[model samples]
Target: MPVRALGYKPVYDYRVDQLGDQGGAQGSILVAGTWYCPSMPEPLIEATSDLHAGRIDRETWVAHIAARKPYRLMPKESKDAEGHQRMMCPAEAGKVQCPLKPRSLGRGVHLPLVDPQPSPTRPLKVCRQRAITLAPEEGAEYWQALDYGDEQWQKIYFRPRNSVEGHANRRKITAWLDSLARGGQRPVRRTNRRRKTKPLGTWTPTGHLTPAT
Candidate 1:
């Protein structure tokens, strides 16, 4: 009856059992006990459970089943006691096992310092102004200033054209100029005009220079 209903497929079979409500088909109608449909592939029940747990979506689950063929039927002997078959994926199963002590690509590569010998013929030149010469008091004061104001002394003595300290100062000045240009701060640009007192005239005996009359 199951075969007929399923279009007489060789994959499926049904068993009949005598139930109370049998609609007078001799004794009992053929009731399907455990419907075996070999053609209808088994779902990835584990993957489905994973999907339910929000680990994977339906599309990914379908793709995984298609790629892995987890639904493929196995022989009875191949199946476990619980009727579960072990799904072996070729991509995962056929992976080469790594050795305990694997060979390294940089096996022969070693760090070695190569120091070049100094030229004995050519001596390094020194500036006379930069030569070390100072009185005991001057040397003491220099050392004191150096130790006391390390950063300030460095700025004053040996300043760099481009440095963090100089860049910070430039940024502050630029910000002040930008604020002034935007008319945000108090200080504004001032305009000047000249007032003409009088035209050139001949000097008389009077204190003030006046036109001759």
Candidate 2:
């Protein structure tokens, strides 16, 4: 079964009859209205254009697959023997491995960053100015993790089920912190509007209040 988060809807598989004999057979799927070779990484998709332009050789194109980090196929509810959360690569089955590969596109070709970005979701805007408070103990861990700046830190802050805002105010605080750690500018806050008022009183010639206005 296709994973829910991927939003993958399997379409017809490519065959010789549909795409002609030269085109390879690969199952195609739609993701948020975009078609994809479910197993192909975004880098490889980009490499296809470079290959067509004669910038990268076929040998280098094939090597890109070996460098790809394995896809996460395990269900979110699944856990390893030690009761720790587990992830897996689709191609390697149960094994977990790094997905970065060395670039071999000869001179002048550049590869995308090895690490993927964190969630694109932004935190909810606050209605008022308030300090971001975190648990005293976890506060240190969060700061240290943000300072480290790696996938491991992301795993800690952006854990599954954390995307939702519940009673835990810390989630939103950590998200904003994570954004800063990833080089995002601190969000600008809107200034509060000054309250309007009517004239309060009338004054006599001596400057003493005589009556309410």
Candidate 3:
């Protein structure tokens, strides 16, 4: 967050170890600083949520992601050098369908239209709007260098991170093993315990020390 406030655009690597449910206006939910559609299913929203909380296993989380027909971001107003862009909602952009935007239906897109028509109880502005403008400040804290979960993200994040961590861990293991070979009492502290020593023999009456057999 501070990094963005400082006007530096830095891509992030996350552990996702903590629990968070930060959301934004228009019922959009924030994950890694990117906003997602409100109509996102409970399974999709809850995928990482349950896994991080230890309520679900990796396989189930993978299944949840696989089951998702996620909305895609389309550029409506192109981003300028200042890093601002306007995006169309899935309903209008034809990435996914919603009953609210009937024009998007049956456009040969593979996604399904919203089920169970909206009633007065469920009226939402997100349904009415076609596009949203995102400033660099809008999601600066969690803004991604590329769209989250896309092939670009996977390529940029995983391989380099894994390689660096792997090499670092390997070097640490080697150093600790070398310390133990030399009887280091605390390998991490880089301190060794000295071996006890004894005199070969006591001084004799003639001032000659005798060796112990």
User: Candidate 2 clashing pairs?
Assistant: 69-99
lDDT of 3 by residue, 39-148 (tens): 66666666777777898998887666554435544568877766777776666766777766788777765685555345667555556677777666665655665644
Ranking by lDDT: 3, 2, 1
Whole-model lDDT, model 3: 0.63
Give the number of the best model, judged by TM-score.
Answer: 3
Spell out the clash pairs found in candidate 3.
33-142
Per-residue lDDT for 40-107 in model 2, tens only?
46555444345556778877755543343233232234434333332222322322222321221222
| TM-score per model over all chains | 0.17, 0.22, 0.65
Off by over 4 Å in 2: 1-42, 72-114, 118-213
RMSD of 3: 14.0
* Order by TM-score, highest first: 3, 2, 1
For candidate 2, give the lDDT of residue 152.
45
TM-score of candidate 1 versus the correct structure, residues matched by position: 0.17
Model 3 regions lying over 4 Å from their true place:
1-21, 54-57, 66-69, 115-125, 147-152, 181-213
